[model samples]
Target: MSLITFHRIYPSAIPPMRGDKSALGSLPAAAFQYCEAIRTASSFGWYVFPPLDIELKFDGAEVFCFAEESGWNKLSSLYFEDEFWREWDRFAPDDMKGYRIPYLTTLFVPGIVQIWSGLLVSTASDYSVLVRPLANVVSHRGYQVYEGIVETDRFAPCPLFINIRLIDTSRAIEVYQRDPLFQVQAIHRSCYADGGAYAEKIGLGPPDGVTHGMSATEWDGLRSTIRSAQPLRDSQIGRYGAAVRKRAKGQENID
Candidate 1:
């Protein structure tokens, strides 16, 4: 089994979760019953939340922050200090001099700011990490979170942070400790193991596969992909989710 670990010194920093239960609650019965892909995608990874409750105010050019702990004044970004955590700051590389902050205005992109997750993450040597927005969360917030693939297997182990680009600057946005801001999924190194030129367009095979269009066996497989499942109806609705669950429990393959 693969292992991913997060280290933090603060109590308010939220631990990751398997999925957003709130997001799942928003899904209709139809999705939970028949939409295996949607349901699976929603719960596939660990969701990460904000380290503290903070509100951000943006005015098209810059960002300001408000938190009871941080008082009233902030510019560019707010800093949530952890005196105990700052002890590790001395060990960071010289190049990361001013880059490591609890929160920061990343000038690399316009309307974007980085909020520290308040966790130092590391994955097994054979695994990397994908940091992305929560997939199935039902939110209409005025900001878009970035998705990034990080080589945590070989990273400097700086605390992880999520970047958000403001979409509407007129309204203040609040992030609470309980609300997830992003998701982290570990990817095995085998995903990138095929580094060489391994792909070729020999899709049309000699006699067994698709030569002209598709072989008989291939045609049957294609038809069964959807057609075969249509007959497994529960009352009036399809039993895709139930079928998938049965197969997952080693009951049997659907086809």
Candidate 2:
């Protein structure tokens, strides 16, 4: 099996772990039984934790980062190398002439900010990594997480951080050391090929359709599936999830 690992890069760094059911802990038991989509998504990748506790406050003009622990006074105040920032600014687009946002900047723009995850991720040689917000769980206090895919195999042990766009800046946002900050999932490098066949759909659609190839008999079957028709038997509520699990297990049988 291909292995993915996370290295703790700082004294307060915490290693990532498989996502749990906390995101769905508030849902009623009955309501959660059929939440396979959310459950699957939440558990698909590992959760990345923050290195320290911080509270970010905004007054419609600027953002201030504060820390209440020793050796961690603030996020942006932490020391960072300027090598990448210098090179990036030099080759930046002409339109962004006067914009120079540092990698460790607490505030990138008026309402956008960056947070250091304090972890380095490593993956198999042929696989990359996708770093993004927790799937199906919204806990932003006042901002929205951004998604970024990195060819981590190139850098191997890549630094993992997060950038969020402020949505409701009227309140202060806090990040606890015990809480998850982001998520990381592995993806094959081949998925990024120039002309890869990423997906296909069969129907009378505007694009990516096989309208001319779908025969009447095929459409009848497809329609029945979409309509959830069970004329021969009673309909099932979690039938889609059951079918998905069956497909995932394939034809394998365990005794």
lDDT, model 2, position 162: 84
In model 1, the runs with Cα more than 4 Å from the true position are: 20-22, 69-74, 86-100, 156-158, 189-212, 227-239, 253-255
The 0-to-1 C-alpha lDDT of every candidate, in the order given, reads: 0.71, 0.68
What TM-score does model 2 achieve against the real structure? 0.72
Model 1 lDDT at residue 64: 72
Error of 1 at 95 (Å): 14
TM-score of each: 0.78, 0.72
True-structure lDDT of candidate 2: 0.68
Report the lDDT tens digits of candidate 2 across residue range 84-178.
44554677687855554333456557767776776777888888888898866766767788888888788878777787876666776777879
The regions of model 2 sitting more than 4 angstroms off are: 1-3, 21-31, 68-76, 79-104, 197-201, 204-210, 215-233, 246-255
Best by TM-score: 1
